[model samples]
Target: MALNLTLKPFERIVVNGCMMRNGGRKTTLTIENRADIIRETDLLKPEAAATPVRAAYFLIQSALIYPDRRDALTKSAQQQLAKLATVFTPQLARHVFEAANNVSMGEYFTALRELRPLMKRELEVLGPAGLDPTSPDELPRIPT
Candidate 1:
């Protein structure tokens, strides 16, 4: 099995913690093997991680990016999730808790998959950090 993707000029991606960017023209990439690849649009900037769930997701990404600190990051994620439990829907909460467990067990890829739905549900519930939903200009973009 393989993954094929097309990138616009200057689009970026992270493969095995290595950041890569496309050149002037649009390019297609064929990933023939398993690799940790995160598209730039999906990159969660640390500064933008304001909510607990967002922070947890960012921490999970950090665990992947900094293997040397995976344990520490996983611990932080677990603590953050404890705080977020109060606000999470039952289903979302289940996924997050499972993700935390996956992290603790050193199953990072599984943890990441579990956290994706957590992030999505967080946005649907909270509507982007601190933005006022009534204000059209103060919108947020949730990466898919």
Candidate 2:
């Protein structure tokens, strides 16, 4: 199978940690083989990782962008997930566990997908509080 990407002018994507930008015109890219590709819009700025779940997502995102540090990033994300599972309700925690399991299996993308729903749930639970300063429970700093 292949992945097709249609990018607007200047749109960016990170493929296997190499950042590429579309030229002046719209472009279409067909990834004929498996590769780690993350669209620019999906990129999460480190400073904006305010919530626990968001932090975890950012860590996993880092793993995709920096595969060289995938071991360390995956470890940190798993630890964060473990702490999260303890605090969240059983239903919500299930997702955290699933994400952790995916990370452990080297499925960083799947782990991210699993955590997406929790981001929405966190917003509902935290409401405006989610915009506050980063939570102390947020995962440790990830190298740039």
Candidate 3:
């Protein structure tokens, strides 16, 4: 039995990451096409993964809009970064700054890098709450 599939515009179907621009048309996937997509996607994955800091930075870009909450998130992200700082090199620092800068969280990034060792040493004395990291979902909510 043969099956027919329809895709809408802006719809993305990634068989191997060769992103078929579904301009409201049906495109057949061949072995070569699938392989090309996969190879390209694989090559792009690392660059994609590197953008999280940029994302975080953008998320925190409106820091002035939510000073207290931004401050809290900054503090938490910094703490996490600090804990991992000893293992993080200057290259990692650059990446973090790049990401932070993308979201205007440069100050937070700087603070985290500076306080990494202190935060790590104080981890033992800190409570579980202090050790717990805040996720975006845990951010302060605004009433509708």
- Candidate that would win on lDDT: 2
What is the C-alpha lDDT profile of model 2 across 1-144, one tens digit per residue? Answer: 988899999999999999999999999999999898889998878877888888899899999899998888888888888878987888888899999988888777888889989998888889977757665565358864
lDDT of 1 by residue, 55-112 (tens): 7777777776666666677777777767866777796778877887887876666777
Runs in model 2 with CA error above 4 Å? Answer: 135-139
Clashing pairs in 2: none
Q: Which stretches of candidate 3 lie over 4 Å from their true place?
A: 1-68, 97-144
Which ranking of candidates, highest TM-score first?
A: 2, 1, 3
TM-scores of the models, in the given order?
A: 0.69, 0.88, 0.25
Worst 10 residues of 1 by lDDT: 135-144
Q: Order of all candidates by lDDT, from best down to worst?
A: 2, 1, 3
Clashing residue pairs in candidate 1 are none
Residue 22 Cα positional deviation in candidate 1, in Å, after optimal superposition: 0.9
Q: For residues 35-139, what per-residue lDDT tens digits would candidate 3 score against the true structure?
A: 212111212221221222322332333232334465665554444344444544675565554434433434432433333343343444454455444565544
Scored by lDDT, model 2 comes in at 0.86
